[model samples]
Target: MSSNRDDIILNVDKLSKRFGGFAAVTGVDLKVRRGSIHALIGPNGAGKTTCFNLLTKFLQPTSGTIVFDGRDITRLPAAEIAQLGLVRSFQISAVFPRLTVLENVRVAIQRRQRGDSFDFWRSERSLHAYDLEAWERLSEVGLSDYAHVPAGELPYGRKRALEIATTLALDPQMLLLDEPMAGMAHEDVGRISALIRSLSAGRTILMVEHNLSVVAELSDRITVLARGQVLAEGSYDEVSKDPRVIDAYIGVGHG
Candidate 1:
């Protein structure tokens, strides 16, 4: 909570998005500090995913600006933005089911390390190095035991962990996770939460999560959204106690 504006990692100013007449997000502003876990939470249809899409450049904003590490990146492509160290994991699992767990991560590492090269034989040493790094990342995420197994053969929860490990191999300075806990059992949730906490030790994270307990446990700040706008922004307790947020939840039958 100390003054760390100088450590600000992401700045979103008046970001808005619309689908024709439907406003998905309007005038949402946020500042994510370096190494902080910021959670965005709201009821269903709260525009959380739309906002995430806009920030990650999957969808262009109808208005406003997004600045990452002092660069105005609102107009950048998703791949371009990712190269700038901002990476996002989708709400749905994005993994190569047929590839081995280690191979999936190895591919991601190689892609990030060498860009898009068609010649696999051009850099055998580099490829091997990335494979080793991927194994290490898999170990970090507690998926080492499954490294040689086919990704599709792993349990749902382990597949999710593998996805996170693959993302980590990209060396993102800031990570955007959309409901990383979705579709998981309690044990899986706990495992993924621990992985998230460990991964965020020295990087910035902005996550859209419905699990309030996970948000409370991991977030340093919370942003509540409703009807395409930010209803409240504060620490978990402060946002939870806000009357507007309460009303928003009640209106959505989630209170």
Candidate 2:
């Protein structure tokens, strides 16, 4: 446990989730410090996504509590949680495929800024300002050149970048990424990795990733899950060296 109490940004106490007869997560406790990158890793069926769903209010936990930024938010709705500056990116791309790349991001900004719906007649000027801001965000993710193109027209890698740009437009204090590199090519992986690294400065990040190399490179701390429980929690070096972890990986064949 980190004694630096000042840095604690998110705390989970005795969190558990169940789906009728099945317990997907059990008695998991976690602490994520401000501005730190934390990785959650495990083999398939390890309950990593279940835990994330519970924390982000995509699913209700059967028991336990979640505190974010000093407030208890265990029962908050997903929208409310997002309003509190906790944002998540899905394993699959979640972008408006029919909307222009810039328009997709503009809607995200408008939501965060509490602007009116994307209406041409009611708030054209404000919407245009959001468009400019969206372009700026697109630039941040290196997607500015595609601003006017329909999002579905972009390559898969670029679509993912646009999703990140949309998330950025939300101005989150903490970001949760689930399998961000799942379907990308090696070059795309490197590009997204660099983008993640660059974005981590001054922000808290929690990611669930299957790639051990990426976890090792990006995480300040790592928590391992197995069979609906926490198996280990420590630095990458410590957890990787643990005999149990080695055995688990060997049994799962590098999942």
What lDDT does the true structure give each of the candidates? Answer: 0.86, 0.86
Instruction: For residues 1-255, write the lDDT of model 1, one tens digit per residue.
Output: 576657788999999998888898999998888899999999998899899999998899999999999899999988888889999975224478898888788888877877776356756675666776887898899998898898999998888888888788778999999898988999999999999999998889999998889999999999898888888999999998999998888889542
Residue pairs in candidate 1 whose N, alpha carbon or C atoms collide under 3 angstroms: none
After TM-score superposition, what is the CA distance of residue 53 in candidate 1 from its true location, in Å?
0.4
TM-scores for every predicted model: 0.94, 0.94
For residues 1-255, what per-residue lDDT tens digits would candidate 2 score against the true structure? Answer: 566766889999999988889989999999998998999988788889999999889899999999999999999988888889889975224488898998888888877787335454646666787777887889888997898899999998888888888888888899999888888888998899888988899789999998898999999999998888888999999999998888777887645
TM-score (C-alpha) between model 2 and the true structure? 0.94
Root-mean-square deviation of every model: 2.0, 2.0
- Candidate 1 stretches with Cα past 4 Å from truth are 1-4, 91-94, 118-126
